[model samples]
Target: MKKLQLSLLLMVFLVMAGCSQSETTNTEVNKLKETNKTLIEDYNKLVDKKEKLEMELDTYKEVDENSKHLTTIIDDFIHAAQKGDTATMQANISKEFTFEKQEEWLTAVNGEKNFPFYSDFYKTKLKSWYLQGIDYDKEKDFVRVFARVGYSDGEDSWYFEIIKEDGYFKISDLQYET
Candidate 1:
């Protein structure tokens, strides 16, 4: 009877040990699955962020290119203004621009009167000038380019409003800060 009781106790101990080991393995597997799910979620979020960054980078590149082209256009206009070439200046001006505005430019160029963005006035007054920046208005579908201009007395802010016409950009108006 002692030997039978001992055998029964040994078998019960073995069975309990096996059941606990199996439970531990199941718990480890569940934890691993949860960790894998979290890793997948984190990876997806990174991918989304990477895509958004790429799009923003592309937009900046396009803006840079546009700025370069616009600078060229404005440079040509400034050169024409320095020489008092109305035809070349008119070429850069938008067709939609008013004849009255054209007269203002003509008069300003001839030194008959003062208007903002007169390169001749700039010729006499400005020590140095450069484009500050460009902004696009989506609502109006127009662009404004700011210029950093410093004349003999003081620095002033100037801007040229640009618009697309006939699939090309043209200057429509000029302004100066008070």
Candidate 2:
């Protein structure tokens, strides 16, 4: 009887030990599952952030390309004016192109009537000229180009407003800083 009692106690201890170990393993498994869930959530958030950044990058690229193209147009317009090429200037300018100063606006009836004066003004008045930069207002569909114009008196900055019309960019208005 004594031996049987000892054996039963040993068996009970072994079963209790087994149960304790199983409970510990289950707890560890639950913690691991929770950690995995949190990691997956973090990964998803990172993926979303990456996608957003990529889209922003694409938008910037498009804007940069547009700015570059507009800059080229401005350069070509200037070159045409310098060469006294009325046809090129007329082609690049909007039909509604206007000269704006202070609060006053002036428009020509047509390019042929107006370009000669502009050609003379640029050639004689502006001793030297260069493009500084170009910016776009997407909502307004307007491009503002900054230029440094050198005159006999001094140098001045000018803003040229370019607008999109009929799927082409055209110089709409020119403004000089006072």
Candidate 3:
């Protein structure tokens, strides 16, 4: 009877041990599944962020390119003006040119009487030009630039109206202000 009782106790112990081990394994498997799900979610979020960053980078590149091109246009205009390349200057000027001192300049060139020193004016008054601002629309072929004309004694601000005609950029008009 003792032997039989001992064997029955050993059998019960073995069965309980097996059940506990199985439960532990099931819990570990569930934990692994949950970890895998979290990892997958995190991976997806990273991919989404990467894609958004790439899109933003592309947009920035485009904007940078446009800005560089606009700067080039401004530089070219300033170069032309500083060199007094009339052909180039006239090409870019709007159809009409306006100046607060337009009549004075014209009258000086026209040899009008009492128009203040004539030949000396042309030799000393016209000086360098500086580009102050440039703006353009990507969809439109027009760019507006603000420039400062440096003379012997003072600087004057002018606006250059730019447009693309027949695949060439030209200044359509010149305005003293506004």
Candidate 4:
């Protein structure tokens, strides 16, 4: 009878230990599920943040492709103008511009007496120039670009009219504020 009692006690102890281990396993599983849920939530938030950043980056581009191209052309033209490079300037201008201002456009660096209407452009060296804005004239079918040029004398407003020719943009006319 003593041996039987000893066996029963051992079995009871084993069963209780097994129940305790099972409870501990269930708690560990719950903790792992919570950790996985937290990781997923964090990942989703990061994705949302990334998407927002991309959209903000797009908004920073104020100029479209066409306008951007026009800006580049104007910048190049200004650089050429500073050096009185008639060839480079003419390359950016339209044939009509060349035809309209034939003598002045071709012989801007000839002499003081024969200087172009904007003689100061070829005489006084410029400091800097900045693009103010660009607007499209729907009815006129042209893009009007405004800029400010700073020279040794002072600042002047510059206007450039860009027109589409042969599927490309060209300077139809350009003048400065007197």
Top candidate on lDDT is 4
Give RMSD to native, each candidate.
Answer: 7.2, 7.0, 10.7, 12.4
The residue pairs found clashing in candidate 4 are none
Clashing pairs in 2: none
Model 3 regions more than 4 Å off? 73-178
lDDT of 4 by residue, 1-178 (tens): 9999999999999999999999999999999999999999999999999997786554334235567789888988877776656677777777564422444453332222222433333577679888999977655767889999888888888788888777777887777774
Error of 1 at 62 (Å): 2.9
lDDT of 3: 0.59
lDDT of 2 by residue, 1-178 (tens): 9999999999999999999999999999999999999999999999999997797677556657788777777777765654555577668778764332222212233333332224333334547778897776655657789988676677767677888689887888765563
Tell me each candidate's TM-score.
Answer: 0.54, 0.54, 0.43, 0.52
Worst 10 residues of 2 by lDDT: 99-108
Compared with the true structure, model 3 gives a TM-score of: 0.43
Runs of candidate 2 exceeding 4 Å displacement: 73-104, 107-124, 133-146, 158-178
Q: What TM-score does candidate 2 reach?
A: 0.54
| The 10-residue segment with the lowest total lDDT in model 3 | 107-116
